[model samples]
Target: MKKRDILFFSAAFVLALLFGCGNGSSQHSFALGDSTFMLDNKPYQIISGEIHYPRVPREAWRARMKMAKAMGLNTIGTYVFWNLHEPEKGKFDFSGNNDIAAFVKIAKEEGLWVILRPSPYVCAEWEFGGYPYWLQNEKGLEVRSREEKYLSEYKKYINEVGKQLAPLQVNHGGNIIMVQVENEYGSYGADKVYLEMNRKMFVDAGFDGLLYTCDPEKDIVKGHLAGLMPAINGQDNPAKVKQAVRNLNEGKGPFFIAEWYPAWFDWWGTPHHKVPASQYTGKLDTVLQAGISINMYMFHGGSTRGFMNGANFRDTIPFEPQISSYDYDAPLDEAGNATDKFMKFRAVIARHLPKGEKLPDVPAAKPSMALNAITFDKEIGIFDYVGPGKVNENPLTFEDMNQAYGYMIYQTKVTGGAKTELKINGLRDYGIVFIDGVRKGILDRRLGQESMMLKVPAGTHSLEIFVENMGRINFGPNLLKNKKGIVGEVTFGGKVLKSWTMFSLPFDKVETSKIKETKSAKQTPVLKLASFEVAKPLDTYLDFRKWGKGVVWVNGHNLGKYWSIGPQQTVYLPAEWLKKGKNEIVILELNKPEINQLSSLEQPILDQMSDNK
Candidate 1:
């Protein structure tokens, strides 16, 4: 060879090495229309598991991701809840549990791929379906629409999230391969323009990764974009799913199941639901056998915590709230423990892996503890306990009371002569009215009526009304500005009552810890506390069967509500929250004394209550 040719070849080799191609293996780039989710034109299959960051504790994230990997999943899919990250419109939180960028980085370090599903509107059955309540306060702001106000806010959220995740895409040497546009938009409406607008926003924000739409097969035609890939959701039949994809797209690219439901989510006052493990095993086997790629709807469903659970208003006349535990019967339980379903799914995936492929070992489930009861004496009356002269003129709405989240109390004085016909003109939801220290009547929003006949002794008598803000209306036309407490007017007999005193009980960790014993002079009972030590941690529910409705907090974590009403039996207590030496348990039962005590039972509270009642 010529001397010049040899020098040129050596220089070219050095350049190739500097650019990361000296070994002849090139950097990968994710693209649609390639076989099996091809990146850089090489075949790949994504075994993805869905886990929401806000639902799981930050400390438990790595373990949960390890759990997914151990289940033979190579990818993790998550919904970035807009409401959680940005509780207020302008304010944003990326620290603590909202550290999604950290979570993704951890996934990369653990050798796992990622799919980012950041929805300014994620209907994960979360509070307001993951939309901040403040958005509803904007005048004439239409959600999931082309309205200017909604679009402006949506752009703000998209830009913020994009800034956090754009550099993490596959093209940027990170694990994120694809980004999903608006979740299941077709099921809600066939507004193609709105869908395109969302897609353009993602691209404009500098997310160059392949974008796609995930919707049930039937809705794909209306939801999917012409150039982008369409992933099917919840369909188990591989052949039918492939055919559906082909029909929708003229057989252009690889088929993917973006959301395969391993199990369903539960609501408070509803039976604990479980889908047989055997059924899921068979379904997953069939899909993998056909060489199709898939992602579990939730490999691990975590808790909604606090007042974040969304409600549905479909069957009944009014809206019903969702329970806090999002334990969707997935392969991974709320506590991150592997169920029988997990083992079966793992075995199935292992059987299909190429030669030399092996899954990691599953992590051991965390510990849980059962606590002993702590009892306290009642002293203060609910009305008399109010601070001196801090009352308002009219009953304050939940918002006006600065109580954006929980229960509120309204007290007023009735000054008319003994009136038999007592009426509360506009009661928002459920309310219990007490005259002088005796229960007068119950007003339910379900019936949309609030008139009660009371035996009143003429002249000045204290009238106390307690109202609970049930879960907000999650779907349909009523979703706009769901304000709790009384919305309209309150009348007693023929005359209206004024000069009201309002108390806000937006329970916080500090307030819960400083709870004081009720002052005896007052009538309402103080919430009780109890503690007990167990030899080892065990998952158990603080049985609310014998108690009236209210909230429960164990080790400062809200375990959701337990009502004496027929339905939900057990509230989930993750072993992670309990300490072996000692654990504290507190209950805020609505009506007290008669059913004050709680017991720990092996069976779910719903079943046990059903059997006993």
Candidate 2:
């Protein structure tokens, strides 16, 4: 009887051990401060690189993850761009490039952890800082605040994103270990309630991983929560790092540099920002020596592609628009080539790792090419092609003209007497007005100047005005606004003119291709045709440094706005977008007439000589 009782007791003990050890709770629940970022208590150090899902194409997700891992990064930090995921109210996109769940699953397959920063407002210098344009349309919607309307929409976004990622958190056998609250909130505002609301939403949505806030050292005090970890962003000073922890936690347990800037981004008409490789390498070494962890702001800053780069405010200026190419002068260039900064940083990291630990080999650089001369002829003025539609008596704004993006041309015949005082009433941003064949006046948005006076020939003369929609303002007081073309009246001798014929040039690829030649006295004098051939498709930058100013296209894909301005000379051309054998290139130079020939260089167009010089 004793032997049988012993056998029964042993079986019961074994069953209990198996069920308890294999329960779901064991796999979920990440514990920081413990080694391995322990689920049920283990040690973990998250080595992550920041990558935005919308910035990188879906086809390249796995490849990019592989690159991150190869760089000795065990985790991938991705920010969920609200505008891309939910461009319209109540509508969401989790497919293709917007498929964040697929991206997380693929990261797991690649043996990488995830740090999710699902900021409904991600100020990655992205258009509207990742906020949807429709949010701006809402009358008086306050961003990054506790405003009811804004919070309501933000909660909806968090829920939708959580549905895709909450189940994949480390607690759920997936690799996501931490979910970030509103990105850099303290720098924008001191809405602790809004930040807490965001945190609660993620927790309620089932994201049980560690919750944290990222901001500069000064912001740590205001931005961080008492219970959660505080991660600093863009802080390289050691004292600042220590202070960030002290300010947030009176000396906290886990401290990380969420974003360490390796380089800066270039804006149109501004000088290219190039931080020395030595400075970046030294900063990284200092942080690592102090045993502080950091994530390179962008291990690889990819192309902005299309109209995605955001704009900022400058005192009195309406907006300071960023160039489309977000090259960022990063460790990895826009085309994904490892720069000198990459090598220096890698060597620095390799030196600091534990003994016998070696950094992975750097990936091979992709190939690039320069195209021969390509030319485009402007056979007619854009206004001459207007069809049967009745001409509006007054000029229309870009939106009123039903043009969402690109350039528009307004032309009128002046029948009144010539006057020295000519004023453009409501010029939105910039305009180049020409009276007959002579340049009359220039209006710029930055100065808030909307008119210019020019000597005019009396009685039936051509008045041509060309206006471009500068990238929309993405932040600050005027965010909900749209500015394009001439907004008001054209006045000559204190009297406003009427009956203007407008030409809308949104530059749709199809529409541009169908443009036909037309003869008009106002038509451009030179008709240029240029062609180039490439043996294989490679990422090539058309040197805009040659032309004064213009827009360019490679095989129907618009490369975005290029100007002969000082700072941005190079436009990025992705290899995936280029085609083999005879890729067509087109350019519409604004100020240049006789200098028609165009050629591509091996380097970036921004690298080309400044047109102003």
Candidate 3:
């Protein structure tokens, strides 16, 4: 049971009053107690749902928060993805969808308390676990540890996050009540000293109010800190979840479930994961009946747009990359619409609301459009526009060459006219083989296939392999070194292949204005494009089941990658990025251009599994 009491940190409360008075906004006090959480000397129950700012568009932030409240959420949980905020080494991006402060502010506007999980490393199945790709290039840097170089880089970014969000804390006249320490660290390692150091970093960055660490049931003991509150994640047993945290929290009573999953995420080559609401609403009821403070892992799981989705790989499991749609099948769909789960969860929550308080009306469904097939006729030869290549005696990994996402073209001269067994020692993810602009075979790291036999015309022929970085490993021990492209040597006829010209084509921005019309590209890679007009823009799904493997862009905004593989056959195109006039769509097709036409659907085709294997 929760107990409403006086302030736990008197000094911080007084400071909050001062700050709040300065801003002319009514201030609120939130404190952690031995048995209950106190909000203004009264017990406060936090019913939160995790939502990422980067996943949802900037224009739809308020609408999403409204949806959360309508579903009976009192607070919102969010992870500030470091990679999305700071893509480069020294440069930082907090504008547009990366504007986390804006997201939090909107949450407050919608009457929701904020739980800021500003992660130096957040394993939300995000690329590199939300660690910036540039971190891989740092010399002698070890992640999620107390390594000097690693901590030093982290301090800068954490301070920047503090500068943006700390003042908006609940104590300081804003709705931010709790801030989490290094996300789910015990799932990876047990280093109390390292975690303590991380906690201190948060304090120095001005997150001195209500700090906590959350981990799985088995890991709570290992990741627990004696000084801060310990929260459990992934535990469904209400009584067990309460007891586990109570025993470890020095006899505290207010239990918090950090990540309660209603459903799971899907990867390529798997069926879409859907959890029936009836299966989990009873558990939600049990948690509320026990007075446990809980947060849904994803009240809404939006799209993992562009190359931001993550992958899973370890000794136990094979290389499995996450699909483009992050739509975790939560109460809110990927496009931010209510589902059957939403109605059921809302009913369960409505029964537990305080007297005289009722859940708001669910928002109207956002509009969606279905249009005719948008044919892509114009083609651009990718090889001709590959600009230049860096010469190297050996193959350069994606990180070594200072590249992150997209394809890396490795070109070299090879003896032809004879059947030679070609082998690549370290193909990171997936690649398309070509000899003098003609398709030969494919090498996929997921399938563990490295060697393929090829025979080209006589004389020296250009050997080219287009390697696509599916996504970096987001969990487990393998994530420390998720370098894309070729990590080892390429050999033919059992002889080491050398003298490479590496082309780093991340395609951060696709420039297709200078395209030349081609008759056809049945055997090589090509840039596919199409243009369409809309009097009024609305949300639509770019149905890509007919398309082969490639990355997509609409009006220069990256929509992310697509494959012939299962689970994800369409990319979510938001109306926010659309316009009232003409819009252009671009695709970088790596394989055969079999896509003569593809339609924009009114609804997503997420469960359309293919037997492409």
Candidate 4:
């Protein structure tokens, strides 16, 4: 049903050959035909699973690849997070966990091909859709646009990524068979010119392998270019998926599902989403029977560590920040253990592997440890750890101060109106208003409340607003405008507030030695210190069910945030970070520190997704 006629840019291919661009020590060739792709001119089917290199630790990359191979997968797909690769403009770090080339090379060693989705803009519920925080300050630089300012920066980043990956392409005698162009662009806009530019950029950067555009079935036509191959996403209906792909590619036979959602991601205050196996099983079978290629969106979703989690703002939802755990309820759990779904999926995948090629043996489970309740006796006042702040005439946004993540404090003097109407125009997220170090009121964006009537205690009262960078918006129309902290002017009683001393507490400078011991905190947001001893280092989840909302640090490494209002009661702590005998834990409790005991659980309480909504 599919045409085998080769369709390619002859000039580019010839140039690639002449320049020895496609030449490599390992000999292999990959090219796109009408219906299906070809390996050495033979029809090939890509049975792949998506996994992020940065999400999983560098030590775990090989094991994860083996897990995928054992599940009867021939290919492993990954997105090259632009922000992770290049946190700042012109500053690139490919070492440690950011070593994508190493990840790919490991996949090759595990006998698996790779699909590189290097989107300068990756909307994987990542901070600012993977755009660097510095981009916000660039005037007139609209992100995800074809505008010069944005594109110029993007070109440099993509070129850098290419430098790391182009030579590893399948045509270059490497395992990287295909490289995606501008991830799911059609879902965002109907700009053909933009898609075209992205395709050209890939070719220019030395990716001579198959280049394709993946879009939602509905938007495939809008997102696709004339020459590039089109793939559908989030569509389980085999008939519809095939129809969509064929319609776009003039009756092309072999269909590919770019992102097959096994389960969905979770937000802070909402129930975790799950797709029952029964619901997706039949569709998966139908597609496999029809000979369609699919890449499970997330085969294994590791933690969204640090402040990289993104938020979701829908029609009714205000702004829901994603929880640290990216555990998408996939075949592999957050801890990389195989779920029941994994076994079942393996059974299904086994039915369609190439002749005589068998799946590898599943790896043994990693041991987890349970520890006794450790008490936190020492206490530190949060106010004592304040960094040297700068004085400004007006409060600056987090981007203005070049502070990317964590919290910021805006302190100034307020007077005049007795019941002053305090308004924080464009408040980024949760902000607690304090008058002269006393808690006055709370201004939260979730409740859709911004302006609060403040009772200005006579004369000049010290006004302090502590704002936390909850998370940046990851997808949709509001993506380009996701700047943390306050964006616009703060007005009180029709008068613009000025002459403010702001603290840029990015928390990157958080050190245990720097904090002073205190007897007690008068109010909420107090820092507590505790130490626990482990027989030996083993993987454990730090349970914070007793504590209120805030963050936890284990041996100076942030375990991420936890709240009483949780589907997530504990943060995952890798064994590598835990020392043998004594381990120190620090918690910055935002609300009441009701419990002082800290314990580690062998199992994680991730799916409590009740009506915390």
TM-score of each: 0.85, 0.82, 0.95, 0.92
Clashing residue pair totals per candidate (backbone < 3 A): 18, 16, 0, 0
If candidate 1 were superposed on the true structure by all CA atoms, what would the RMSD be? 5.5
How does candidate 2 fare on TM-score?
A: 0.82
Which residue ranges in model 1 land beyond 4 Å of their true spot? 1-27, 376-396, 415-429, 441-453, 494-501, 510-514, 518-525, 529-541, 578-585, 593-613
User: What does candidate 2's lDDT look like per residue over 1-613, in tens digits?
Assistant: 6999999999978865533231222245667562124445544445567777666656667767766666667777888888778867888988877888988878877767778888777777777677765675456677777788888888888889989999888766777888888888777777677778888987887877788888877666777776778889888887777666766665554557888888787776667788889877777778777667677778777766555667777676556777767777777777767788777776777776667977667777778887776655434444443443327888877666655566777888775464567688767566777777555656767567776656665667888787876666665555555546777788877778888877777665524443445323442422223346667877777676666666666777667767776476767776776766766666655666446566666777453335362
Cα deviation of 305, candidate 4, in Å: 0.4
lDDT of each: 0.74, 0.70, 0.86, 0.81
* Model 4 TM-score, all chains together: 0.92
Over 474-552, each residue of candidate 3 has an lDDT whose tens digit, in order, gives 9988877788899998998888988999998888987787565754655667787788888898999988777778888
lDDT of 1 by residue, 1-613 (tens): 9999999999988866543321122355877653367867767777889998878878778889889889999889998888777777699888888888988887876777889888566778777767777776778888888999999998988888888888878787667888899887777778888888998999988787888888888888877877778889888798878887887666755889999998887664467677889978888888888878888988888777777777776645565666666778889877788989999999999998878989988888765544464343432334443434337777777766545566667778887466566676656567877887676667766555578887788788988787877666665556665767877677877777788888776665424444455433333524556666766767666666666667778888877766665366557775666777877777665666335456665434443234332
Candidate that would win on lDDT = 3
Please give the lDDT score at residue 246 for candidate 4.
85
After TM-score superposition, what is the CA distance of residue 524 in candidate 1 from its true location, in Å? 3.6
Candidate 4's C-alpha lDDT?
A: 0.81
Model 3 global lDDT (CA atoms, 0 to 1): 0.86
